[model samples]
Target: MLVEFTALHWIYVVFIVLIIGFMVKRWDTSLISILGIFVLAIVATGDLTAALSKVFNSFIYAITELLSTILIISLIVAMSQVMKKSGINEVMVAPFTKLIRTPTLAYWVTGILMMIISWFFWPSPAVALLGAVLLPVAIRAGLPALGVAMAMNLFGHGIALSGDFIIQGAPKLTADAAGIPVADVVSASVPLVIVMGVVTTITAFIFLRRDMKKGTLELVGTYDGEKVEEKSENLLTLGQKKFFALLIVVAFLLDVLAMSLLKLTGGDATALVGGTAVFILLLLAVVAHKKKGLEKTTSYFIEGFQFGFKVFGPVIPIAAFFYLGDSGFIKIIGEYLPSTSQGIVNDLGLGLAALVPLTKEIAVVTLAGVGAITGLDGSGFSGITLAGSIANLFGTAIGEGTATLTALGQIAAIWVGGGTLVPWALIPAAAICNVSPFELARRNLVPVVVGLVVTTIVAMFLI
Candidate 1:
């Protein structure tokens, strides 16, 4: 076996299956996640004390990795609370109401806007930019909070991110590893991206509409399982509301412009949006609560932080367990993985690639499977290199379609891990809409799986 396939690797694989089982059954995976970490530590180190401590250490690693996302959600929620109370959210969404009058329109409009902005700025910052503005409008138009979350997730993270046409970040990683041109990967990915995007979005929409008509889905709009209480009386006058609303719009627009001109993406772009939100929150807090401004600002932050941590509590353990599959093993546990091992996840991907025969049908299937396995770490980008390497091996043997195979792998990795099906990965959309991340993941499960299956079959012909 490659990389000395040991008990530790088997342990990790077993727990992954168990965790997935828990998630599919709608059971809490926190216990299983923590148990997995402890067992892995014990098997790796043979120290009970160390095993116990690794559990705590893994959570620290998960939170450290997740803190930026937490902060962004906290800031956005704080700003949203103030805006909602001052009634500026109403004014901000008024123009959108004209364009999105029904649930179907709300789903498509929000999804399309999310896709366009995500292509430019990427999904994290795009979620921050769009969620506060469009979520309210969508809800008012009869789309459930979960439905709005689905739209943002599928279009932004699944479509825009998988194709990554403008940023070209995804294709660059895969193409380099596969020894192909970046343009080839991008060009090849277009049809696969379209197929996945269309299938997932339409399936999600149809399910959402069906649930709504059946009255099986809850209609309440919440941000952390709590209903937003609208202010009985508007603190801002008509003119004030309009002025503040436009000011917010202009401020975010300027941020978007700055993102393009300064070439800020990912963390830098997210920081810009976060800073803008803090300022907006302060302005609204002071205006709405005047003499009580200072106290009110503190209270709003408390509210936001409370929601952030509350939402993340269940996620930390599962994220920690997944992290161990990557570089996190060295950090959270120890450097016990053999020197030749390319981390557990990557090694497993390579192992699977080694086992599969190099025919186009098996090549495409194995690439998708390998991509998905690597993506279990939840950083979709972390594993595309492995996907690309496998694509190269299969392509070399098959004597053709390297780019198409690589593109298919990239699509599968991203759609599974970038944010659609993974609970923690897609939490931004879930947090912004105030829906449960796990529930959002569940809602996304069928659509994403169907899309991946259909896209995989389509790639057979493309190859």
Candidate 2:
């Protein structure tokens, strides 16, 4: 497939590089991201007034995409605030403290559990369900809060989401695009996913341990590191605390059962969890506070919203810029591209695939590279069709390894954009752990890159 390259495409490519460079340097990319949106709008619409409007419209679009995640995180936090005040959170995590006695056990146990839950419920709800309960336990076990975030992120968002074995969403998308059965892609992906997961997770653990030993791990703004004032009065008695704790657990377990029985996934699954959190928050607040229940519910919500927005504020501009790379351009700047355009991101991916040589080795490297490139937009699913199409083309030319190539591309795309290396995409874990998303992204960079490299080499052999 021949894809037309336009000025709009070039402008987007340049800004993507600039944004990534800024992030690598730990510099705020909000200004550059906003500028990128304005420039893209001005060039596309050729109307200064329309361009100005797009700047604001882009932010709205970004927020809309992120609102579900924001709501779930806030609700979980609100429920947690009451749990903490009532001593329910402590009670809930007490059992885990026995199992997670050391930092090593905490990291692996939390990560493994997150990966399992994410495979079923997906990472957004998994983060919410586990973070509140396990974060405190992990921290108390001597792991830094950021370490816990990385563990959840790498396992839940990176490993489980990339493979998507149970949900099969990722494999289905790529397989359909490749004109193959989903099972073929899933079968080929198992080895690749295992290789990538084990290598990346082990590398991360080694680095985390090294940093801990050197006393160089950062703890800024984390739950363990921050100094939060505690309420002097215990709102709930031991019986009440234990009751609410058990109720919380049973409610989430029912959510799991409902998800399995009703075949709920993604947003529906997240909504179920968020709604349950709200109910728990209200019940705990009213029962604990008595006459002040109404006031306290609102207060807890306010606190939760404050935390949510603060964590998400820096992310909005960056997400806005990237959204334009996919579907947001038409919405924010009007339908200004040529009719042949497959949005800027897909067009770029196709153009890159067209340029690469079709040798087996080059095919392996190009698939991984193209997968990572498509992931730059931060919606891991958005550009995967391009990866699948490219895999089909390369597989035909090489006369083999179509399934393996497609699987490799899917894994690379999701690991990079699904929430491991991308700052905004991984914000749920960061926000829940009270760590900086950029720092989490930075910490993930080396391990993920190494894993991709090794996985790419393994793909070369498989091909």
Alpha carbon deviation, residue 457, candidate 2 (Å): 4.9
Give one digit per residue, the lDDT tens place, for model 1 in 145-239. Answer: 88998999999999998997654667766775666777789889999999999999999999999999998876644545543334424688989
TM values, all candidates: 0.65, 0.66
Full-model lDDT for every candidate: 0.79, 0.80
TM for candidate 2 is 0.66
Candidate 2, residues 31-138: lDDT per residue as tens digits?
988999999999988889989999999999878866775676577667766776787756765666679989999999999988976764567656766787787778
Question: Which parts of model 1 are misplaced by more than 4 Å?
Answer: 100-232, 358-463
Cα distance off (Å), candidate 2, residue 252: 1.3
Return the clash pairs for model 2, or none: none
Clashes of each: 1, 0
Q: Which whole-number lDDT from 0 to 100 does residue 156 have in model 1?
A: 95
